[model samples]
Target: MFAEIITIGDEILIGQIIDTNSAFIAQELNKIGVSVYQISSVQDDRAHILKALREAESRSDIVIVTGGLGPTKDDITKHTLCEYFGDTLVENHEVLLHVEEIFKKYISSPISELNRQQAWVLSRAEVLHNEYGTAPGMWIQRNGKVVVSLPGVPFEMKHLITTKVVPRIIEGFKRPFIVHKTMITYGMGESAIAEILEPVEVRLPSEVKLAYLPSLGSVRLRLTGKGPDKDQLNALVQSEANKIKALLGNLIYGEDGGEPIEELVANLLIQKNMTLGTAESFTGGRIAQKITSIPGASAYFKGSVVSYATQTKIEVLKVPQALIEQYSVVSAQVAEAMASNLRALLKTDFAIATTGNAGPTKGDADVEVGTVYIAIASPKRVIVEKYLMGSQRDRVVQKSVNKAFELLQKEILKL
Candidate 1:
């Protein structure tokens, strides 16, 4: 089954507030095997809302409307819905009790007439009680299609959908099983990865679809399948995933939900019973931040030193001042020295180091901007690589972090 979402608010169109309700509703619908046909945002004007509702009802099996359901005059969704259903307003005693209960719990003063009017709902609709707010949800059926009206507040809308709407949809409709699998890849652009997986993409089954979602330095390949038999669809998705894996091999770092490369490195360190540390220059502790972001990181992560200045690198990390003079601070030699020093100081089995000029202008060392050198120090040996990233500072830093993780993963697998 398919559904359409309509968010009614002038604030959304005017950029006063973001419309996060549509995304939440769409995700919930997908979990229950209902595909979102389209998502739209309409102004608070009654005529615009009516047009949107008519358009949605003609194409969707179910229509969900949110916003403008409050008791204020600008809140016209309830009245517009009344006109659409060819019905009139009537007071519901059960809803009035719910409203009064909510007021009694939160409001110290007497409830006003405007708040009391929240109990008046359309006579033709079935009321869906809202435990979180005074405005109750409504469910209406016309010509065998379903229309649900909900409050604009995010928490209240979520509660109503989770408690009342989802169960009803599951009991009322027969839906196909849907599955999604994602694979994460780094060190390659989207078009290159697409070219490499062209053969596998062309041979995919009709029910399975492939999408390449790319970020700064990585691409996420998602495979979505829909079918009546859950096991068969899962097997089909796995088979296609295996084909792509065979073609890509270690280039595919991780899978499903597109886990970051730092998580992969952390898992590898834990499995091997090893510890890790970092000595950073240009990245400015981002590598350490990413590592510590994973829960229980202290088990395998030692610590990091952000020796940004040359004197700090010499005094703290003990990189030789002579070495910095011989080769520039952004040189591969300095990166290797930083890594080796970090591993020795922290007593870790492995360490990652980065040194570079991440900026819009060239630094005092006479090196061009985006000149980065990353090194990995393993128990057996130290390896370093040089890269020329873009001129933008943030992009350069992000790319450096991604490359550092990729290189560390490669070295970990080698051991």
Candidate 2:
């Protein structure tokens, strides 16, 4: 089945707010084996929204609309949908009770007439109750197509879709099985990876497709397969993934499902029953923050020292003051020293350190704006690498952090 998502908000059109609702809706729809034909964002104006609705309905079997569902004056989705479906507004007692209960339990202020108006839904549509908010969702079927209007608020829309809309769609429609496999690779650019995977891509089955998604210093290779038999589709995807794994080997660090390099490194540390720490300079505490973002990180992650200043590197991390004068702060020597000292200070089996000049201008050390040095100090030896990233400060920092985790993961694998 094919679906279309329409996000209605002047804020999105004007770039004041991002349309995250559409992305979430698309992912959920894809999980149910529904292909997203098009995603659109329209202004809150009634005419624009009506035009988008008509266009989406013309091409898609399922049209999901979000936003402009509040009780405020600018909220015109319910009224415009009523016009589209040729129905009138009628009071729903169940919705009214839900709104009343929400107001009585959550809000201390007395409910106004506008809040009460949330109970009035389209006469011909099925009222999908929203337990999270006052705005109720509408499920309208015209001819053979389905139109589901959800609240613009993300949580409310997500709750309704997961609890009501998806179940109903599953019961009403039969969809094919879709499987996706993603491999995370670092220390290589997209162009290089694509060149290496050209033969593999050409040999892929007709049911499977390959896509490369790159960010900063890493690239993600995603393999998607579609078929009627779930087991066969999964096996095909796995077979293809194994082929790519044989080609890439250690360059591929982890898989998809939010397991990035930091998570991969954390899991390796936990599995080996070893602890880790970090000493960061130019990357700011990003390396440490990524490590701690994983749940139960304290079991393997000891702590981090953000020795951003030269004096802090010397005083806190115990890097020699003379070494800073010798090789400057943004050199590989200082990165190695920082990592080794941090490992000793924190009493961890392994440590990762980063020092770089991430800026629009050259640093006091006379290095280029994007010059970075990352080091991983393991129990046996210390490995250091230098990189000349782009001039963008955020990009340089991100690349440095990613490279640090990648290098750390590589060293941990040897253990």
Candidate 3:
């Protein structure tokens, strides 16, 4: 089955509030084997809402509407739904009780007539109780079609839909089994990854769909399977995913929505009973921040020193002053020195250090912009890698940080 989600809000259209409702609804619908065909956003106007509702009903088996069901005046979804379903406003004692109870929990005042009227929506819809807020969710079934209207507040909508609406839809509809798998990849651009997997993409069955979702430093490769039998569908997708994995190999870091690179590195270190420290210059303390964002990182993460200046690199990380003078701060020699010095200073099992000119302007006139050096200090040796990234300061910094973590991840794997 298919559904269309219509979010009615001027805030969404004007970009004041993000339309997170659509993504939540789509994922829920997909989980129950229902596909979301289209999503639309309209302002709080009766004519526009009615038009969108009509179009949605014609195209989809179900139309899920949210927003504009507030007690306040710009909320017109309830009234429009009433007109569409050929019903007049009627006072619901149960909904009024819910609304009044919600108010009493917050304030010590009695409910007003306006609050009572807010609970009284068209009786045609199956009044779905809103446990989180004053507004009630509505469900209407007519002419072999279903339309569900929910409150715009995310928590309230979540409670009503998960507890009531989704169960009803699952019972009412018969849908094919759907299976999906995702592969996460890094160190390759989207176009390059796509080109590498083009042959695999072309040979997939008609029931299978492949989607590429590219992000800041990685691409999520999603493979969706739709068939009558759930097991058969899953097996088919898994087989194809294995083929993609074989082609991509270790370049495919983790799979199916893995943790961020920093978290992955931290977990690996913890698993191996290793401790890590960092000495960062161009990246500031961003490397440490990313690593510490994961819980339980304190156990494996020794510490980090933001040696942004040459003096700090020498004094804090204890990078040799002679190395800095000879090769400059943005050189591989300084990066290796920083890693080795921090490794000894912090007394950690492993250390990662970054030294680079992350810049719109060059750190040294002759060094050029975006010249990055990453060093991973292992027990045996310190491995250093050089990169000349783009000219943009932020992009250069981000890519350099990601690459440094990736290199550290490789070093951990070796141990």
Candidate 4:
């Protein structure tokens, strides 16, 4: 089925509030096999909303309206919807009681007439109760088309869509099953991976499709298959995934919504009972931040030292001043020293260190922009590699962190 989303608010156009409701609604609709035909935002004006509603009703099986369902005079969605459907507003006793309870339990103010106005819903529409807020959602239908009205507040809209809207849609319509499997591969660009998987792509069945989603230094291969039979569709996708994995091998790290590199590294560290630390320079402790985001990281993570300045590296990480003098601070020698010292200082089995010059202009280091040296100190030895990431400062920092994890993962496997 096809659906259209209309987000009503002048605040969206003025950039006062972001229209996050459409994205979330579209995602939920897609999960139920409803394709979003278009998404639009309109001002609080009545004429504009009526025009949008007319256009959507002509082309879409379902129309979802969010926003402007408040007690203030500017809120016009409920009234405009009543006009479109040729209905009138009436007081719903159930909704009136709900509003009164909300004000009594949480809101200290008494129920004024304006607050009581929230209980007035469309006379002909099915009221979707709002357990979390005063604005109750509405579901109206005419000529076999559905129009669902939801509150613009993100949490309230989400609650209605998940609890009230999704169940009704599922029971009311038959939707095809959609299954997606994603493979995350590091150290490879999108074109390279696509070229390697060309044969697999060429042979994919009509119901199955492949997509390449790339970011910075990695590519994600997503395989989506759609059909009526859920089990048959899943089996077909898994068979194709097996074939792709056979070709990609270790280049394909994780699958079926591929886990992040940090989570993968965390699992390996915990399984092997190894501890880790980091000494970050220009990379800005992002590596440590990513590692610690995983749950149970404290079991294997010791600590980190964000040694950004030359003085901090020399005094805190205890890198020798003569070493920074001999080679610029952004050297492999200094990176190695930082890693080895952090491993010893934190008493961890493994340590990662990074020093780089990522800039719009040359910073303290004499090296060119995007010149990065990354070192991983394992129990066996310290290994360091140098690379020239892109010139953009943020891109260089992100790429450095990714490459650091890749190197550490490889060394951890060796141990």
Give the 10-residue window scoring lowest on summed lDDT in candidate 1. Answer: 359-368
Segments in model 1 whose C-alpha atoms lie over 4 Å from true places: none
TM-score (C-alpha, index-matched) for candidate 3: 0.94
> What Cα-based lDDT does every candidate model obtain?
0.92, 0.91, 0.87, 0.92
Tens digits of per-residue lDDT for model 4 on 1-415? 7899999999999999888999999989888878789999999999999999999999998899999999999999999998988999999899999999998999987789988999889999999999998889999988888999999999999999999998998988777888888888888788888899999999999999999998877788999888899899999999999999998988887874557888889999999999999999988989999988888899999999999989999999999999999998999999999999999999999999999999987777999999999999999999999999979999999998998998999999997
Candidate 2, backbone clash total: 0
TM-score result, candidate 1: 0.93
| Position 93, candidate 1: lDDT | 98
List of clashing residue pairs for candidate 2: none
Task: Report residue 213 deviation for candidate 2 (angstroms).
Answer: 0.6
TM-score of 4: 0.93
lDDT of 3 at 377: 98
TM-score of each: 0.93, 0.93, 0.94, 0.93
- On lDDT, the stronger of 1 and 3 is 1
Q: List the residue pairs that clash in candidate 1.
A: none
Per-residue alpha-carbon lDDT of model 1 for 380-405, expressed as tens digits? 99999999988999999999999999
